[model samples]
Target chain A: MSTVRVVCQQLAPRLGETEHNRNLGARAINDAAMLGAQVVVLPELMQSGYVFKDRQEAFELSEALDGPTLSLWKSLAAELDIIIVGGFCERLDDGQVANSAALVEPEGRLTVYRKAHLWNREKLIFTPGTAPPPVVQTAVGRIAMVICYDLELPEWVRLPALAGAELLCAPVNWPDAPRPASERPGEIVRVQANAAVNRMFIAACDRHGEERGIDWVGGSVIVDADGYPQAGGNAHRHEQRLVADLPLAQARDKYISAHNHVHQDRRPGLYLPSP
Target chain B: MSTVRVVCQQLAPRLGETEHNRNLGARAINDAAMLGAQVVVLPELMQSGYVFKDRQEAFELSEALDGPTLSLWKSLAAELDIIIVGGFCERLDDGQVANSAALVEPEGRLTVYRKAHLWNREKLIFTPGTAPPPVVQTAVGRIAMVICYDLELPEWVRLPALAGAELLCAPVNWPDAPRPASERPGEIVRVQANAAVNRMFIAACDRHGEERGIDWVGGSVIVDADGYPQAGGNAHRHEQRLVADLPLAQARDKYISAHNHVHQDRRPGLYLPSP
Candidate 1:
């Protein structure tokens, strides 16, 4: 069984500054490579930040999937020989924009996934994505890509898992307000519930530092299939990179030995749809 | 604004001991009434403990809604002149046993709710309840009663709220296992989430003490519509009653204000159901 080294890169980019944001992303990738990581994940909309003043501003930040963003990431993947998952603003040819995440392979091959569950303000800016999520086959393992709010919707994650995705990658930019520090455990509880219920390794990378006058909760975490945090970032501090050696074989064994048994027990026909 | 004194009682019953359980319940009600509690909520299955070895035992212990259990509660309610929520095992005249909860008025009138969601192990003993939950109009306000697992199922709680329930009463007999003492905050998170999302005052009473070799986590709590715990029972102790003045008027006002303005913002049609 090959040991897989994964890194959760918690980077905070200045909102609307494409050049500096891209540079920071590149630096994080380099840092992961230095730590001998086979896979790396970044936060949601790492380039544009979470708050968009208007739809027009969000559209201005959007780039084609094969545009300069991919080109830069492709070069980085080839240079490091590692898999990189990162978020970006995607502009379709028809002028519709989507908050999207992309999985870039070491050889420059890429798989893109648009955000399925849009947040409140995001509904005003980006069009809702209708395409089913993409689960790409990587040298390390099967990987699925998703963006911020997509994680909140179980169907969005469940679909990818059913499609044979062993690892789910989420790039989130959660705003730091409405909930106080005392309620931080509640946030972790939600994340843990998602991991335990799904029985999958969730590598969720959240944005760190202040952006657009709002503080971003920087709890970028790598939760095991059992819903335990392996290694990651914290809510208050800006962590550059968190690297951990993951046992893909153990994860495979866990799924086959226990999760498969649980799946057989699910009475899907009787389940009430989300209300 | 009229003040309402609500008492959230955590009733821990010894499994299979009906007589002792009945005495304990009667004592709690009398104590709460003496303390000036206008409303009191007892834990789920107060007459019979959570775990029943087999259907025979459950049926043997079960009584009709108007049988000895309700009869005892009726006398207590009339004598105390206080509203009481108590849980029981109902033996339907048709020979089926249903986990049930009853809301007893001060004048001895009764409104009962059968458990909607039967959890693990329970499915083997109790039949799934077919009757829709009923919200009775009370002198204090409109109140709805539900058994343990019913609260975990959103529809069980949500339907009653839609039917004009200002307050939700949950009687739970949660087992103390799986979670370590360090994870106490994780337990409270669910209570807060349920209260906040429902936008209705929730009086959740949980059982305490060890019964039939299973330890019950005794953190019976009363949460405001906004998910704040106004009063709570401690995790360490057992067989305790907590009394607090629940401001029903403030909760009603908040719910109405949010409904009139934010009702249009709820895009239920777009939101996916959570698993």
Candidate 2:
């Protein structure tokens, strides 16, 4: 009965409102900690907001690792004795910027992962990361971080899962699109599939509200190792808080059947490195 | 608009009832062709049924490429001017048996793919395949084939999708599992996610009815490039037929957004060959 209380705060951040967004993030973290959450996740680009007009604007909003937002998060994490995971626009060398997420532990340790697979206009706005998603061994459980479209690539997800990540926390801003009525959004469906295939838990925090005429799906979800939604598997078009207690132990046992172990059953020899 | 009508006939096959199962398959294929289907898919092990009593029993039911089942399918495919994809127990040298599927095109070209990933009890009963799933360039469109459990591996599915398979026709036997009410089965969700990530069309046919006290999910589904079900996305407990006219041209255009093409967007270099 080893469980971890996870929280995803689906918030709306105004574009370029760094100070306000930092406050919003602090409030969400405090609320989650009060509810006994051991790990709290926030949406992608919470510091500067998504839907940037151009690379120049994103660079203007980007923050360094020592910047106020991450500094505040690091302090809060240590003060609350909880782990915090959230996205921010990262300031890079030569006036470059990257979409990055930071995982701050209560012990003042930090691990950062830049978005590897850039979504739509993000190609023009940020430099894609060359390193794989980072899987950190935290006190609560082994956790990993990836951003938005990175979840779409199962190959990318497999890296961390094989590396012994029990829970994958993603910060996403899923844009709204027309879908069949009464069907789950494909974004959330993909997340469930990713979790199930690797026998890992996933908590994806998505943002709400429209930014520059782009409304989001607001489809934050937490799926168990079997890929079933533990909480918030719907598209709620408003600020929401999704909380779930995941039996992290279930992820340690990858066997779906007596003969099959998810990771061990894979035949990578047949799969080419790059096709 | 170049469209190809695909049909999935979910039928039950009595174990070791080769003659009866042949008639059942012939009837389903005829029915699909009558419905103007260019391609028809059937469930895994349709020729010999799943839930074998032992390895000896499965070997006894195994057939070669020139066996009556595939021979009949090849004749029917050429005669009816359509493609038929279905599963059977393949007899290998030295009394070995492999769970395999055959894709018979209108030109009488037969492509066989052995199930690389075996399920519970199957590993004891059958020899696992070493070859990857086969993608064939058919007259209707470029199609591929893989059997059940193999579908659970996204890396295996990616092999065909990356090989320019516009549509992947799978023959699956999804054993019934307890799922939350009003939720789509994880098997179907994985199918949708695979299609969406690859921007490829997929039609997976599952069987119905009880076999040796083992019931099935009967979750047959046909998903378009966008990962939305065009037909049969539910778990019906009886024999059923799912049909959809797929404009496979959409699969060729991998771009989901202005900047992201599903295949081109893949950062394969970062993904390890054997992770």
lDDT of each: 0.72, 0.94
State the lDDT of candidate 1 residue by residue for A191-262, as single tens digits.
554555456677888877775677767777776665566775246557556677766544444232222332
Worst 10 residues of 1 chain B by lDDT: B256-265
Which of the CAPRI classes, incorrect, acceptable, medium or high, describes model 1? Answer: incorrect
Q: Could you tell me the lDDT of residue B203 within candidate 2?
A: 98
Report the lDDT of model 2 for residue A70: 95
TM-score of 2: 0.98
Give the CAPRI rating of model 2: medium
What C-alpha lDDT, on a 0 to 100 scale, does residue A74 get in candidate 1? 91
Query: What is candidate 1's CA lDDT for residue B184?
Result: 48
Instruction: Highest TM-score: give the candidate number.
Output: 2
Error of 1 at A264 (Å): 7.2
List per-candidate RMSD values in Å.
4.7, 1.2
Candidate 2 residue-wise lDDT, A103-151, digit = tens: 9999999899999999988999899999988889999999999999999
Candidate 2, B1-275: lDDT as tens digits: 88999999999998989999999999999999999999999999999999998999999999999999999999999889889999999999998899999999888889998898999999888998888777788898899988878888999999888888999999999999999997899999999999999999999999997988999999999999999999999999899999999999888998888888888888777898343
